[model samples]
Target: MHGPDVSWYLALSGLMFTIGAIGVLVRRSPLIILLSVEIMLNGANLALIAFARHFGHADGQVFAIAVMAVAASEVVVGLGLIVAMGRRNIELDVDKLRTLRG
Candidate 1:
């Protein structure tokens, strides 16, 4: 039995990325947008790991780990903003956040 091909992995990553892009474009809630961005990041990480395995190199895996760290930081910052908005009684709607001008 043969292992899964790289093209299969690439195709799955592409599909996941497309779904994430759609979620980002179509969602209205700030939290949803953040989640969608995380999805996109995960999709990219999936591709990186897949390529690393295919190429038998560590660079892609290293970058994937870096991406994971960035994603974690993103969640922290995004949730902080959400909590701040809640404390300030700001709406969760992304369209209404335009008034946040300092």
Candidate 2:
């Protein structure tokens, strides 16, 4: 049986990306920004896999894997920084982080 059309996948991906963008723009917490970035990455990944399936090729899947790897590394580094900030009793708000400027 046939699955959902590519357009449906694209619509979902667009919606996810839009939500993530909005979260990043409206939220002041660094943690929320990181999560939103992850969501955007996931949305891109979904579009990549969907296109790969539509084209019957592995290239999109390969790129999606690469994106996932990058996203994982980003999360690791982001969480590490967040933890370090917490240990130092620093505010978690993104606006407050500007004080970190030398």
Candidate 3:
């Protein structure tokens, strides 16, 4: 059985990245921005895995794992900030958060 080609995977990855970029640029909520950043990371991971598969190399997979780790850390920190903002009764709008002074 044959699966979809590398081009298809690349196309999907590009589409996901584009959507994520648009969301990050247009969305005002911190939660939405975080989600969009996650989407972008996933999209890059997809491309890395696809290329790794195409080249029959383990490097891409290794990089994907590293990327996942970074993404997890980013989510942790971002969510922590959001929670702190919430605790302080601050608005969740990114545009209004020009200064994160406590």
Highest lDDT: which candidate? Answer: 3
- Identify the runs in model 1 with alpha carbons over 4 angstroms from their true place: 100-102
Candidate 2 per-residue C-alpha lDDT over 1-102 given as tens digits, one digit per residue, 9 for 90 to 100: 198989999999999999999999999998999999999999999999999999999999999999999999999999999999999999898877666692
Model 1 per-residue lDDT tens digits across residues 1-102: 178888888888888889999989999898999989988898899899998988899999999999999999989999999999999998888877665661
Give the lowest summed-lDDT range of ten residues in model 1.
Answer: 93-102
Ranking by TM-score: 3, 2, 1
- Using TM-score as the yardstick, the better of models 1 and 3 is 3
- Model 1: how far residue 69 lies from native, Å: 0.3
Question: Model 3: number of clashes?
Answer: 0
Sorted on lDDT, best first, the list reads 3, 2, 1
**1 versus 2: better lDDT goes to:** 2
